[model samples]
Target chain A: MTSEPLVLGIETSCDETGVGIVRGGTLLADAVASSLDEHARFGGVVPEVASRAHLEAMVPALERASREAGVRLDDVDAVAVTSGPGLAGALLVGVASAKALALGLGKPLFGVNHLAAHVAVDTLEHGPLPQPCIALLVSGGHSSLLLVEDVTQTVTPLGATIDDAAGEAFDKVARLLGLPFPGGPYVDRAARTGDPAYVVFPRGLTSPRDLERHRFDFSFSGLKTAVARWVETREREGQPVPVDDVAAAFQEAVCDVLVRKALDACRTHGVNDLLIGGGVAANSRLRAMAEERCGAAGVRVRVPRPKLCTDNGAMVAALGAQMVARGRTPSGLDLLADSSMPVTVVAR
Target chain B: MLLLAFDTATPAVTVALHDGRSVLATSTIVDAMRHGELLAPGIATVLREAGADRSDLTGIAVGVGPGPFTGLRVGLVTARTLGHVLDIPVHGVCTLDVLAAAAEVDEGQVGSFLVATDARRKEVYWARYSDRRTRVDGPHVSRPAEVATPDVVVGRGATLYPDAFPNAAGPLDPSAADLARLVATGSVPVLEPVPLYLRRPDVAEPTARKSVLTAR
Candidate 1:
């Protein structure tokens, strides 16, 4: 039997330095070293702090990934790394480390997109993505919709959030409620025990009259402020605030808008397959709502395991493997890290 | 004993080839914030001029800084990767130690000295060396005036903030020869070199929160 190609993936776009090894879409190992605890005190990422954390975690994460994959470093056939759309300092650590590995091993190098990797990871779990699908990438840093025609070739932007992203809204609202740093999970948990209709928070960019104007676009800054103002008014009036009730109401507003927009795009574009990826996709309420709404609309929804829902190396490597399988060209040694690398094109 | 040393701590890419006997060739390109564009090409030119290549390297040395985040990553990453590729061990010498090694101090009198480098954002990256010329405390970003020190201060960092370091070094006196010599001694620690980004990025996306003054 011919040995399958061993593709190693490295990701350091954010607080986590993740490394994973895969063989023909089969996940062998997935290791991540997170600096979430370090940033928890600040309630948001400090770029400098995140960069230093990447430098420290790079070597150790790679070692753990190789060990778990049960393969020596030399056994790796190709290397894939996330090259953009992140903190420049943080991105450099992963890119530079990857280049060195690729140069040393004399292996082919593939620079994968962090956002595309989020979409590509689904193939690892669900076999293959149906072509002509829409990808709703909602993370702390990004909230955009894309029309993905292929895993390796085409990803055209459908729409994106105009102001604060969906995840950022969760974080901001959570802070207003005096919750933890990562508001997504905290609010999701708190909402389960509370009532969704208690506050009647606004759903941004959603109006029957304005439906034709921004059918696919999203806006969360208004939602975030609305939550803040509601909390402030309760405190000012000395009306005892119900944290759970507020959390539930805020989460419902976000989910309601997200599902409604996604379904609208699906119906308009006639693309029935909807895929959601990123950190906020890990929210239980969002997952349940997506399932319920997609079912009612008779549209299919594919979401990776919760672990793959957030940033990870497996997604980057999976994207790389798919590119290699399709004979996509690799990036030049001089490829610069575009901190704002768009979610379109491969090996630029 | 062949040693390859380079620093991207500043806008300049300084490359040196030392055969343990003498310095063969030292080349520098002053492109300051263009390290991502000039570093590799500068490396190629330096090695070509020295009549050597990656295979001829025995040990690699790098200035593990207290420098700008993006620029410092290039040098450290290149040095570490090169060390791994050549199967030669790598050594990380402090940027201040390299500067101190080049100081024109009195031959027998190792007086108290301060080494400061521009830490950007109206601050200096500083470390103090005593009579033994041992580092006291730093690789941190602080006002030069605030970096409690004994006497004469040195390094380009002090030069950038003149008022901060009243007694500072003359110019970019930091040489790769000094870095090469330190690596040969094997005295510096092998800890992974981290870019000393002491603070967060200055710019953040605008938050939609009402101004605190408005709330008040």
Candidate 2:
């Protein structure tokens, strides 16, 4: 039997310099060096700090990944790197390193999209995805829906957030609630003991009037504003704001709107398969509600493990391997980093 | 002995190779924003021009910066990787020292000198040095207009904000020759090349969970 192609992936789309090695769908090694802590104090990623962290971490991560994979750098068949949709400086570090490694090893280089890789990663864990699935990606930098015909080719965007991604909203709201930086995990923890149905937060861009015009699009900025107003009112009235109740209620509002739209897309496209990716997919409420809703609609849903759900190198590698298997062209050494690179571009 | 030296802390990427006593090859690409894209190719070209391969490398040297995060990473990553691949020890020379070295050799001055490079966002990475102890004064990210008194001020940061240091401090000459000499002699120190990000990223992601390393 022939062996699977050995693919090495590098990710520097954000604060982490992630290096991973994969044999087909099996993850051989995953090494991530994150500058998240440095960014946390600033309440976000400092572009300059992230770029430097990626630079310092690149070689060490590559070495760790190689050792973990039990393979030499020369053994890597093709090198894949996240080339865009991130901090330009951060993305460049990985791109430049990948180019050097590829040139030195005489291997092909595949520049993959940070967002599409999130969707592609489900294949590594859940096996091949059903054709024409609706993909909902929610992360610190992005929130979008895609009609993915195949993981390697044809990712058509349906709609996206106009302002303030869901993850950003979560962080901002958590901060407003005095939860902490990186609001997702904080809200997730607080919601565990509170009631999700306690307060009715407005569903952004989902009103009966707005739905007709921007049905699939999302807007978390308004929702974040609503949370801020509610907290202000509570403080004005000399009332102690129950943290768990607010966390649960706010999370429910977001989860309810997200699930409703996701299933609506499934029905609209006549597709029964729905795939969830990105950091927000780690939400317990989102996962539980999605299972409940998709089950009732007879639609299949797939979510990767928590580690894979967040920004990492394995997903980029998985997408790159798919491109190679499908005979896709490799990128030139002159490939530049695009901080706002659109998802439709194949990264050639 | 042949050594490869480069610095990406500033917009300009300067590369050089020294064969023990003299310079064999040197190249500098000026692009404040494209250090990551231009650095590796520049290094490869410099080495090729010197008629040296990876196996011929005796040591690798880089100017570890208090510079912009992006450019600094590109140089450090490339130098460290080259050193690891070639199985040679890598040295990190302060960007200021490199400037001082260049000043000493080119200007033929034998006294103290001050070096400063732009840290962007309205700040400068500054340092002070003499022939004996190279005193790294401030890697602080602050406005150049606010730099304190110094003996000599040089590098692009000084050129951009001349008012930052208006004393007879000395000459403001910028060159790559000193970096080359440091690489050849293994005189630079060995330190972690992490960026000196004085502030946080614009967006914060809360990490309340204790680290896995600490949890167990």
Candidate 3:
């Protein structure tokens, strides 16, 4: 390997087929193909549909990334792939692809964790991470709080959603509001013009008693039920539903609980740096709220650009480069895709 | 043409390395729920036993399935990825054809038989093939009782429902060697590596929008 290894990363953990090329800490190319439009009719991502889409898009995305990077496939020093905590069939496409690439090119392979990759991505936008930082990951499938001593090595999970993930909550609430699929952005847009104080939505897992037992853990199912019940009551009363207000109120509740717990974890753990990631981190309200709260707490906040926050191969590439630079051992040819791979195993 | 072939459409995971004429090495493991974990190691073991390396592969042949969604994609995606990286052509063969081609039949024998594999949900994915190994009919999914019985039946589906198929024959799962052989001899059409999901997916699109207002 050269002083700056050129690593190619493949991510098909969900509905997106992403390929990225990176040299050391610098990103050269990032290409993504999404099956969001196909899943829209279903109101959510269908695992089978997502898996089929990945098979169709993997080759094109790889070619596009390589072309955009201005590098040949043989020039890559290593191959990295997301191998877990995703839809089973979806994860297989990327893992299998990475294996083939590594075998064919005779390069080292790294099977990285999807969640830690989210935390590692911030390093690409902002320099190397400060040791022992806290990360809040909110996505369609997962929501968790992690303590990262080193993204390339160790990650400790502090808490996770007990029920629906943050993104899933948004999608369910958006459907109740008669909004389109992928409710995060639509809810954000609708919340922009409305009053956040319209209705007092429940803040789940934040009560004094709840905190004593599960401090950092989150629960959005109760909040989702609250929103659904409120809308149902309004309909039963023959009242025109205030869609914007409900959206604003719901968004407020989610952001409030998320920001509160994240900061709490940092304060309690005596860690000063905090990073927010995952698809839901792309929410404008969440970003602003996190920044504001962290600013007040004298804690530094790091969030990657919106594109990096969502599922992308650049994150995997970034993580892979760090592993290579640190002189970590590459995975054997028999690496497997662990559908329920925990966040602590950064690489396997 | 040197080739690597594998199939994960059934409980059995089969991997083989073959030259144009004969199979060098083959391994088949019957692991019900470990296809994702077992496939790569299986491939590596076969390559080692065959005294070959990954770089020696000239092509890849995969079993595209009318089988379970999760297990079927494992083989196809791996083949596609290997093909893309090696810059070689990849061929997709119908899994049922792999089993039919491996059947032992006399050269002059002229008859039609059924090749059925388990499709889960109390159904089987089956097709009809002549003694010459040409697909004569089917590639359909239906209940075992509903399918019209042929003179001879083969594959896991036959063993699954013995009463429906009294005349069952050799081999349950498709052999990886047969997949390579079929690709080498041009016995099956080389189609796009798209999966053959015989039935619709389990999930469905939303039928209508929920109303915000209820009748007073």
Candidate 4:
């Protein structure tokens, strides 16, 4: 019996150096090493810090992934790497490492898109994506709505954040509240017990006039500012800032608009499946709201397990395996990392 | 031992194949911005020219620079990955040392020589070598005028700042053939295959910046 092709994927688009191996849809391994603690003191991911960490972690992650998968490196049929829409310095580490690995192993290489990989990751958890699906990808770097025709070949951007991304706002607000660096989970944790209606936060780009131009685009900068101003007013009047209430209200505003527009996109496009991916997809509230609202609207929601939702090599490898299964051309050894790569070119 | 050597630390993306005793093939492209796009193909060209499969390589050598971090990391990461996959030992040769090693053959012999590369921001990454093999002083990043160097100079820093490095001579950057030869002959120190970044990353702790928080 001919077994499925074994593909290896590398992801160093951000602070994590992730290596994943997959055989068809089965996720054999997803090994990752993060430089999160190193960047914690900086309060943000310093590009240089991330690039340095990737170089240090790339080999170890690859070794661990292959070992965990119980496959020799030579058994891998193809190598895949995230080639763009990330920190240029950070992306180069992965791209260069992958190029060398593919060259050394005499295997085909696939330079896949980070955003599209987020959408394709769901296939590993659930199954092949329902064609003509709507993908809402929200992370520290991007908050975009996409229409995926074929995850490996075509993805159309509906809209993206004009200012701050969804997860970036979480970090900023968390910092304002004296929370830790990542702040997304901290804000999520704080919002759970707090009342969502305590202080009404302005929902961005939802106004009638704003909707005319940015119906699909998100605007979280305004919401982030409103939270700051509200906290400022409370302090000016000698009222202690209520952290829980603010976190809850702010989280509610962000999630409300995201779910509302995502479902709207699904409904308008006559699509039944809405897939949520990216770092913010790991948020419990975002997942719950997406599932609840999509279900109510007669739309199915698919989110990879929280572990697969965030950046990881398995997602890139999953997309790559699909590319191989579909008989797509492999990327050349000279493929450059496109820092602003559009989601349209799913693989290069 | 069959050796593969490559360097992206300099503007030139260079790759070479060596069969212990002599160089088999070499490739170099002098585009500073295209290191990531060029290095792998450069390696492929050299291996193909030498009729070598990557599995035939018994070792890998890389020029770890005091060069710009982005380009330098490309070579280091590639070299490290290639090493792991090929199950071969990878050596990090100081980029400056490689330049000096080549200069010795070009200029015959020198009591001492200096090697420098573009450090940008009006500075140079340089070192003073007692010969081709023994580095006496640096691997320092400083303004060209601030460095007191031996009159014999090699590397792009001399070409870029001839006034500060007045008596410029020899190859301006490392040659991969020279890097391969140096490693095959064991003429220089073989450090761990990590970049020799002589400076800290240019980022300040969050404490130095004003917080985005409103004044309370």
Per-candidate Cα RMSD to the true structure, in Å, reads: 4.1, 5.9, 2.3, 1.9
Model 4: per-residue Cα lDDT over A199-243, one tens digit each: 889999998999899989999998988888887777767998878
TM-scores of chain A in all candidate models: 0.97, 0.98, 0.99, 0.99
After superposition, the stretches of candidate 2 with alpha carbons farther than 4 Å from their true spots are A37-43, A46-57, A103-106, B18-24, B50-52, B104-113, B121-123, B128-153, B162-178, B186-216
Residue B113 lDDT, candidate 4, scale 0-100: 78
Q: Each candidate: fraction of true contacts kept?
A: 0.23, 0.30, 0.66, 0.85
* Per-candidate interface DockQ score: 0.29, 0.22, 0.56, 0.67
User: Per-residue alpha-carbon lDDT of model 2 for B1-216, expressed as tens digits?
Assistant: 877778887777888888899888888878887876777677777878988875677877777876776677777776766666556777777776666655533244535556777777777777766552366455566676666554456677666776666543322433345677766665655555444555554565446532212222
- Cα displacement (angstroms), candidate 2, residue B124, comes to 3.9
Give the native contact fraction of candidate 2. Answer: 0.30
Looking at model 3, residue A198 earns an lDDT score of 100
Residues A1-348, candidate 2, lDDT per residue (tens digit)?
978789999999988889988888888888999898887776767887787678778888988998999988778889999988988878888887887677556689898889889998898899887888999998888888888887776888888888988889889888878887789999999999998888899998888998988898899988887778788778767999999999999999888888888888899999999999999999999999999999999999999988998988888888888888788899876667778888888565
lDDT of 3 by residue, B1-216 (tens): 679999988888899888988999998998767777778778888889988888788998899977787788878878887888788888888888888887655536537888889999889999988763688887899999998484678789988988888778767988898888888878777777778888876787677645544566
Which of the predicted structures, 3 or 4, would earn the higher TM-score when compared with the native?
4
Q: Residue A80 in candidate 3 has what lDDT?
A: 94
Docking level for model 2:
incorrect
Worst 10 residues of 2 chain A by lDDT: A97-106
lDDT per model vs. reference: 0.79, 0.79, 0.88, 0.90
* Tens digit of per-residue lDDT, candidate 1, span A236-322: 789988999999999999999988888887887899999999998898888899999999999999888889988899988898888
Which segments of model 3 are wrong by more than 4 Å?
B105-110, B148-150, B207-216
Specify the highest-DockQ model's number: 4
